[model samples]
Target: MKIQVLFFGITTDLVGSSTLELNIVDVATVADFKKSLKEKYHQLENLNSYAIAVNESYAADNLLLKESDVVAVIPPVSGG
Candidate 1:
């Protein structure tokens, strides 16, 4: 399955791209996708934490992903 991934804030810098079209195994879960990303982009593992949003909504690790799903990687934010 293919999906669109969006990177935000520090994530974009880490990945070197604001967006990517990736091909993943069918019926992969959010956790699986995340693992794949970390493997492809080792820099991603440097982040303390990040959130995964599917179709504009925060998704859990167990959330199943589908073809063409829009996944966003939002790194932790802090503002004073």
Candidate 2:
């Protein structure tokens, strides 16, 4: 399956791109995608927490991903 990935905040800095096209095994879950990303982007492993949004909604680790899904990597934000 192929999905479009959008990067925001520090995630774009780590990935060096705001958008990426990724290929994943058929019927994969968000956790699977994260594992693949962690392998390719070692810096991602350093994050204390990671958030994935599928089709504009925050997704869980077990959320299944489809070929047409739009995944976004939303970096953590802090405000005073």
Candidate 3:
């Protein structure tokens, strides 16, 4: 299935785009998507402090993903 992924802060810079299409396998969840992304983009491994939103609302890792859902990879704030 296809999902919309948004990158924020460092994630945007690392990904080089604020938004992109994420291709996911069958019966996937937020955690599953993250695993796939981590495999392809090792930088994601360093961003474990972010939150995942499903359809504009924050959700847990086990939250099931939908074809039309928008998944955002939000990096934690680190301004000091």
Q: After superposition, how far is residue 66 of candidate 1 from its true place, in Å?
A: 0.4
Candidate 2: lDDT of 58?
Answer: 99
Tell me the spans in candidate 2 whose CA falls farther than 4 Å from its real position: none
Maximum-lDDT candidate:
1
TM-score of 2: 0.95
For TM-score, the strongest prediction is: 1
Q: In terms of TM-score, which candidate is stronger, 2 or 3?
A: 2
Candidate 1 stretches with Cα past 4 Å from truth are none
lDDT, each prediction: 0.97, 0.92, 0.86
- The sequence of per-residue lDDT tens digits that candidate 2 reaches over residues 38-71 is 8999988778887999999999999999887999
TM-score per candidate, chains pooled: 0.98, 0.95, 0.90
| Per-residue lDDT of candidate 1, residues 1-80 (tens digit) | 99999999999999999999999999899999999999999999999889999999999999999999999999999999
Count of clashes in candidate 1: 0
**What is the alpha-carbon lDDT of model 3 when measured against the actual structure?**
0.86
Model 3 error, position 75 (Å): 0.5
Candidate 2 accuracy as lDDT: 0.92
Clashes of each: 0, 0, 0
